[model samples]
Every structure is written in C-alpha cells, then in structure tokens.
Target: MTRSLHDRHRAVLPDWLALYYREPIEITHGEGRHVWDASGKKYLDFFGGILTTMTAHALPEVTKAVAEQAGRIIHSSTLYLDRPMVELAERIAQLSGIPDARVFFTTSGTEANDTALLLATAHRRSSQILAMRNSYHGRSFSAVGITGNRSWSPTGLSPLQTLYVHGGVRTRGPYAHLSDARFIEACVADLEDLLGHTRDVAALIAEPIQGVGGFTSPPDGLYAAFREVLNRHGILWITDEVQTGWGRTGDHFWGWQAHADSGPPDILTFAKGIGNGMSIGGVVARADVMNCLDSNSISTFGGSPVTMAAGLANLGHLLEHDLQGNARRVGGLLIERLRAIGAQLPIVREVRGRGLMAGIELVRPGTDEADPQAAAAVLEAAREGGLLIGKGGGHDTSVLRVAPPLSLTVAEAEEGAAILERALRAV
Candidate 1:
C-alpha cells in the first residue's frame, strides 16, 4: 500500500523555498520541553525556540488564556485600546520597576527595536548611533544598520553613522580571565573616545547579556559606566533585552536589572519570551523619552488582544509558579555541568553566560582558534541522541547555545548534559 496524495505533497515540497538547513526530524507537536516528530520520535528541546519559550511549549494557562481571548476579541487596532492590552502594559511596567514607562507593543523583536531606535533618534534629534561590536539587535533596516554584525546589513539600507565598542575577548578556559573591573574600564574608555570624535550621537544601544554574540555577559560595572557616559553626553541608553528578558536570567526579571545598581536605561526593548513564543514584542520608554515621539509612530498589529492575553497569562504564570527562582537553581546546575564537561573535553574552549542563557565554545585540541567542524558534529550528534541545541558566535560557529525553559527539571538537565558529553566525545 502507498501513502495518500497529501503525504506525497508534504514530502515533495520544494527544498529551495525553505532556507533553514534542517535536520531529518519533522517536529509535529510539543508540550513543555519535549517535541515529537512526524514519526513519533520525541526530542528534548533544550534550545527552547532560541529562548523564546521561557514558560515552555503549549503551557496550559497560556493556552487557555489565548483561546479565551481569541473567542472574545483577537485584535482591535491601537486607535481604540482594549482592556487586555491596557492590563498587560500595566503589568509590564509594574514588573519592570519603571513606574512611568509606557509600552509600544509590536509583533516581533525587530519591530520593537526599530520603534526604540526611532524614539532615540527622534528624542535626541541626532543621526549617529553607537553600538557594541558583535551585538545582534534585529534584522530591520534601522535595527540591522545599528547592529554590529555586518551579515545582517545585506538589505542595502542607507548607511548611517554608527560606532562600535568592543565586547570582552574569549578566554581559553571555562571562564574568561579578565576581571570585571578591567573589562568595564576598556569598554568605557572606548565609548569616551568615540563620543569625543562623533558629534551629536543619538543613542548607545547594547544587550545586557549579548545573546547572539556568543551569550557573552559584559563586565559587572560596564552598565554603570556606560550609563554615566551616556548621561553625561546626553545620549539615550537603549538596552536590547529581546533574549534576556522574561525571567530567563534568574537574578532579575529583565536582563538590565542584573545591573540595577546602575541607572536604568532610557529605553528598553523586549520580545522573545514576552508571550512565551506567542509572537509579541514591546518597547518601554521613560516618560521624557516617550513624550518626545511624534504621534505618527503606530503599528497596525501591535498589542493585539490575543497577544496581550498571552503575555498577561505568561507573566502571571511566572509569578505564581516562582519560575525565576527555579531558573536560578536549575541554571546554576546546568552551567556547572557544562563547566565539568569542558574540563573533560579537550576540544571544549569555554562555558559562558548567566542563568539559562549559556554557551559552550568548541575548538581544536591545542589552540584558541575556532573549530566549526567540531561544533557542527556536536550539534548533529546531540540532535540524533534526542537533544536539540543551537549554534552562535563569529565566523567560527564554535558556540553551542543552550537556553532551555525555566520549567526544565534537574533530570532533564542531566539528560541534556549526558547527550552533550556523548556528542563531545564523538566529536
């Protein structure tokens, strides 16, 4: 007996149309941190949809909220506000500790970042924007132009005046050797130099913890120093928290809060875990900054009732379940396990990041040079062994990013580590 036409059609879809270089698995369903392929194979999703599913997949509370909101009202354009949207905004402000912050919700991280950059330029009335090297803000024209990675600049947007600051260097071991004080000094000095040369710079943007930049956390006092410089020069500080927000970092609700002693940023952008993978992003601006924007800044699909409902439900679930504490505990365990693996694996270069947002840099046996082949091998081997992971870093692709859900169990972490160990050995 042969399969039906539907099966044949699914099998024969044009490969050229799909850009993702996918593995053999065709995931059909998911619950929590596990996904099942069409062939009924179950895989542990350690990547957590690139850290977008902090509450885990198909969360019951979030699902119920989304369904109920869909039945009532899916969307009402921003022209006429909705109750859920208002409530969600209030909740975000309350959690973020920015009492006067106003949110402009968008459908994706890139759009949120675009809105933020627009605000910065509008507020400062300046053209130049400064960003950290290796930063990954988003893919939109303005956002990509500001991002330090050149690969995203292929869209041919008009070039803008931008300056880049160097993030700390990679160390040869589990942890980098540079002290937080030294790292901060270097970063602040570079920014001062750039500000001295560049006139009327509008903003300085960065990730509290660099996500696509190999999950690298900047030095401890870097935020304080950067904020001081920006304040002194009257430049807006925009922290891109797309990946580090929503309790993923454990110590704080927002990544910037990891450095709360430092003054808060002038503008903050969030998206990835805002709706627990339900597709929502937002920019929270201080009162002065928000008031500077022109009325024309609007989004048709931003802050839809459905997305707001999901965001509210996800936030409530996190608070009720104390997931942040769990993230801290479980994430520490995972990091320790990764460091242990690094000790055993000669090819392992470094283990870095905070809380659930972590990475393992792979390299050749006796050199600091990146070994992309080994990294690819580890990814493939882990996937085949029922654990899904992702990759990041420079041209090397040496970093293995592990950003599992906060709901992840110790047992699951053990399983993931075992798979990773096996993969490393195989490589």
Candidate 2:
C-alpha cells in the first residue's frame, strides 16, 4: 500500500521538474522551532524554512490576521488600492526609514528582484549591471544575469553582459585574516576599473550580508567605499535584502541599517520573512525614481490584501515580542558555542555570520579545500538526530546554513549546538 501511494504521488507531480532532495520524513506540522513528520516524530528546525519563517511557523498573531483578511478579501488588481496594502506599505517605509518610499510587491523573492532590476534599467536607460563574485541574487532571467555563479546557467546558454567585481582582495573566505583597509581599497579599485571599462552601467547590486556566498560579510568599510564609487559613476546601488532583512541580523531592524554609516542604497528589495512564510516580496524605491516609472509596470497580484495583512501582523509580532533582541542574545550564544566546537574539530573550518543567519564552512582535514562530502555527511547525520539544516555556498554543499526563527530560545540554541557537535563527530 505504501509503495502504491508513493508511486501515485510521484506520478501526479511531474517527474521532469527539478527535485529538491529532501529527507525521508514527511513534515506535517510545525510550531515554534520544531516540526513534526507524518509519523508524529518531532524534529528541531534549525533552517526555519530557509530563513523565510522569521517569526516561526503558524504564529498565532500572523495566523489570526491572515484568517481575518481572508474572510474580508484576498486579492484585487493594482487598479484599486486597499486599506491593508496601504497600511503595509506605510509600515515598511517607516521601518526602513526610506521617506515616501514607493513599494511594488510580488509573490516571491525572485520576482521582487526581477522587478527591481527592471525598474533600475528603466529609470537609468542603462543595460550594464555590476555584481560581486560568488553572489546569488535570484533565478529569473535578469536576476540570473546579475548572479555571479556561472554554474547557475544552463547548457548552451549565453552569459549576460553584467560586469563582475571581486568581493574581497583575498581569494580566501571573508573571515580570513586581512586588513579591513586593504580589502576596502582593493574592492573600490576593482569597482572603479569595472565602471570605467563598462558603459551605461545601470546599477551595482549586492546583498548586505552575502547569504549563499558562504554567509560572508564584507570588510567593515566596504559598503561606504562602494557607495562612493557608485555615486562617482552615476550608478544606483541596489541592496538585495531578501535573505538578511526583517531583523534577522539582530543588531538592526533591517540589515542595511547595520551598515548605516554607509549611505543608503537607491533601491532595497525584501522578501523571505516579510510575511513569515506567506508569499509576499517588495521593492522599496526612492520617491523620485518610482514617480519616473510608467503605470503599466504594475503587477496584477502585487500587495494583495491577505499578503499585506500577514506582513503587517508579522512585523507587529516582531516588534511586540522583541524577537530581534532574542535573535541577538540566542545567536550570540550559538556563535560562541559553535566557535568553540570549531576550535577542536579539524573539519570545521569557520563559524561565521551575524545574528540568526549563520554558516559553518566545512573543510577537509588538514587542507584548505572544501569538504563537501563531509558537509553532506554532517547534514544527514543532523537529520537523523532530529535536526534540519540547509546548505549554501558556491559548491551548494560546503556551507551548513543555520537560520532558526527569531523566537528561538537560549536552551534551544544550546541543544542545536550540541546536536551539531555530535553530527560533526559522527562525520
């Protein structure tokens, strides 16, 4: 009977579709940092649905808002603005401190990025875009174009005209022992050279904290220097906050604020946690730039009432519960513990990242080469031990991504670290 059901399920879902390799357990329900499989076996969710569930699964307030809004209205075309949409946009703009910022919402992070790229090129009338090496933006055509990973492209596909700049001078990882001054200088020089070489560059796009790129944070002064260069070249700086926004970083409400010493970017894109796993993403642009765009660019399903309600509720919960503070406190404990573990384990190369968005880079014993096999072993072992984690990096298998919900407790963080240590030992 089980075999027959599995066969039927596989038949219903198209076989040609890309398969995201999942564990054998079929997850049926989730709450606060835990998930249950079909057999009622509970597992600790360290990945938090790839960092999209910022608040946690089925949060009470978010669910209530979603239920109320669903009863009222679901969606209306952009032809008419609704109360929830208006209020949600206002809250986002206030939180971001981007005055009179105009928001254009989408159903997913990829679409949000695609729309932002379109707006950038449309406003500037430029075709060239600058992106950093090892960056992972999104999967849409234009987004894929600016993404630095060549492996993301399919066979026989032509590469986009986007110029690439080295993230840091040291070919080593972002945490390598290098002077901040030298690193920023090298990055600025590269940007200047790239801008000088390429004509009609529309924007320079980057993630505040590099998510898939080993969860790397650039040198201290890198953003300020980059902003100066973009200003000189008359190009806009677009910050992709899809993975880092919504107070996941702990120190600030938005990741960009962590680098507030640097001037704000011209366009900021957010998704993932904005609606706490509800399908909603937004692009907040300067008033002048948004006003310059034509009305025909609006999306039919952007900022639906249900999505806005969910987003608003999520934001309110974050502020009311002081979840960002919890992220900082618990994340600090997790980082310290992981670093201690890495100090003893030869395979654990580095433990890096801010707040809840963190990564552990696995390396071969006694070699600098990435041990993707070992990383996979650790991940599998963690799953077997009732913990779920995600993977990120250029190899897609080297960095063990750990992004628990902001509501995670210190005790839970300790338990997760202990599980990770055991998994590392088994590997």
Candidate 3:
C-alpha cells in the first residue's frame, strides 16, 4: 500500500515546518471564501492562507490576466525593459503616497523587507536599525534580524544591529492600562529614550498593525508621534505592509494611513495580498533612498510578466468593486459579533483588530496567563465545524487569527463567527 500524503510530507519536510492541526489538512481547491480539503470537507476559509488571498479565491479577472500574460511571455528578466513590470510599478508608485516614489519588485515579503533595510542602511550609512517589540517581518536572515518576535527569530547573529522598541502591542505591555492618548505619549517617550542610548540608527521599521503579534496595535497616531522624533535625528521610517496592505484593514488603504499626521513613510514594503495569492512583493521608497545603492542589483523572477499581470488585475478588481468599503462594513459587524462572543467566554482575553483582520486572544479562565492549549482546541474545533482559522502570538501562539478575504460578505462573516463561537465555547 502507498504511504499517506501526510506521512510522505513528514518524511521529506524538516521538523521545523509546522502544520496547523494534529491531523493536518491538504487544501485541494477553493472558490470565493470556501475551500475543500483532499478528503472533500468544505471549510469557510477565514485565515485566507495567512491573509494572502486579499480578493476572492479563484478570481476570474486575475486568473485570466495570469493566463493571458503567460501565453504571451512569462519570464523576462530585469535585464530588458518589461511593459507589465513598468505598468504595475507605475500604478504602485502612484498609490504608495510617497513623493517621487520608486518601486522594486521582489518574490516574497522577506525579500521586500530585506530590500527596505538595504535602502535605509545604505542611504543613512549606518547598520543600526530600530524595530518594534513583538513584530514579525519575514523569515530571511536580514528580515529575521529586525524581527523582534523571538519565536520566529531563529538566530541572534545579524548583519544589521537591531534595537527593539516598545508600543507595537497594546493590551499586554507596561503601558497597556493607559488611555489611548497617554499610551501614545508613553510609547513615544519610550522610543525617544531608546534613541538616546543608541546612535546612528538607520531606520525604524514597523508594521503599523503587528500581524503575527496577534493583530495588536498601539493607539492611533502612535507612529506619527514616533515620526516626529525620528525626523529630528534623520532616521528613516519603513512601514512593513506585507499583511496590512491592499485594503485588508478596511478603514485605511495602507495600515500606515491610520497614523496619517506624519505623512507617508520614507520607505514602504508590501507583499502577500497585492497578487491575490501570487508571489508578488515590492518595496516603494522615495527616490533619494531608493537610489542610494552604488552597485546594480536585480531579481531574476521578481517582476515576471505573469505575476505583474496578476497584480494589475487583482488591484483593478479590488478597486473597481470597492472591496475596502465592503471590508469596513462587514468587518465592523464581525468584530462586534466576536466581541459579544468573547465577552461571554473568559478564555477570550481580547477580541481585537481593524477591518477583516481580527484576533481572539486566549487565556486561562480566572487568570491572565496565556492558554495556548485553549487556542489549539478552538482551532481544531473550528476546523471540525467547517471553519478554517489561524493562530499566532508573541511566543505562545495563543491568539486565534480570523482574516478572511476582503470580499467576505456579511452572511459569510456571520456564519464564520457562529462556527467560531461554537469552537470557543467547546474549548
């Protein structure tokens, strides 16, 4: 008899490659917000492949664009002029909100962030960087160097000297009990104090809304406050929008827009949702910072025509349908529903997030300590109830992640929430 797929996977893959459940699933196909496993069980896909499926699954517009472009030309390396690459870059640059913005394509968020660090360090002539605590950038060596989340960071050695700052997480930090305004002030003061101890900081890279840190975010205008301080010292600000871009957050097109008083970041990096599941990542920076590199560099498959075409079509569809507004309306109702459900359950310490990206923090009943076991139970129970969600947090993995496609409907949201309620109660 042939061995099972899971058995084969375990035999070949490294132990560090984590799977979701005790009996991991093999997602076979998807349509809209629902997907089917290899065993033919349908699941309401709330996680959306870690929020990469910004638009609906199997979107016709993106699929057609990818097919058409692949039929014409698939791979034209950056050595020659590429029309799709230029067109997509132009659109992204115009939308990035940075003055005289330049866009460089990459294959993943890890590479996109790596490029951002390179630009900042080279432009400022410093290897020191500032990153927020409990942040998750990407898995690349450089990206992990700046990532403050120790769980995801595998090694301590890094090319850039990284300093961790406070204020990325709200409800669990030393200043969590403060009012929103006071909390912002405290975090800003903390940032200023951190800068005092260190010099030659090339940049302060932040997620605006920490994705892997359980959807935690400081008060509104926190970054703007930090920007005022960074501006004084000529430190560049880099916004990592890998999980928050393309209207996933509902209220703002980019997560950084929530802190609009500071204007756009000096450098911005994006990935995950722009291609609607295709591997399209990029860095958008002002001309001065982007042009700082003395030598030439290029990504062979970064701006491949097929992926650029997919990005163009996916972005066009997202804007044409006004999915951002849809996210706002539907996501508001979902969050309120989650809060109602959470209020009844002591295991749910918090229900937090903006737009479609939500997190339900699990804790032991009658205690403030994190309950990762409860989180795992809820995840498995939700899967059994025909729902698919994700889990993440600082280090314990105690937060249930609920980030559906931006096009999620009110009915779908309600259905998913109901299933999640059952899962939470069951746990």
Best by TM-score: 3
lDDT (10s digit) by residue, model 2, range 1-427:
3574446668888764443244445678999889997878888998877789888888999999999989988888677868888898888887776767888888888898887787888888877788878787877777778877655643323234688887622336553455777777777777788777777788888887777776877765687778887887788878899999877888877777766766677889999998888989988989976677776556688888898899999999899999889888888889889999999999987898888988899989998888888888888899888888888777456889999999998889999999999999999
Model 2, residue 113: displacement in angstroms?
0.7
Error of 1 at 249 (Å): 1.1
- Model 3 clashing residue pairs (backbone): none
Counted clashes in each candidate structure: 0, 0, 0
**lDDT tens digits by residue: candidate 3, 33-127:** 99999999999999989999889899999999999999999898999899999999999999999999999999999999999999999999999
Which stretches of model 3 miss by more than 4 angstroms? none
Model 2, global lDDT: 0.81
Query: How accurate locally, in lDDT, is each candidate?
Result: 0.82, 0.81, 0.94
lDDT of 1 at 101: 93
Which has the higher TM-score value, candidate number 1 or candidate number 2? 2
lDDT of 1 at 274: 73
Misplaced by over 4 Å in model 2 are 1-23, 155-160, 168-177
lDDT of 1 at 176: 47
Cα deviation at 86, candidate 2, in Å, is: 0.5
TM-score for predicted model 2 compared with the true structure: 0.94
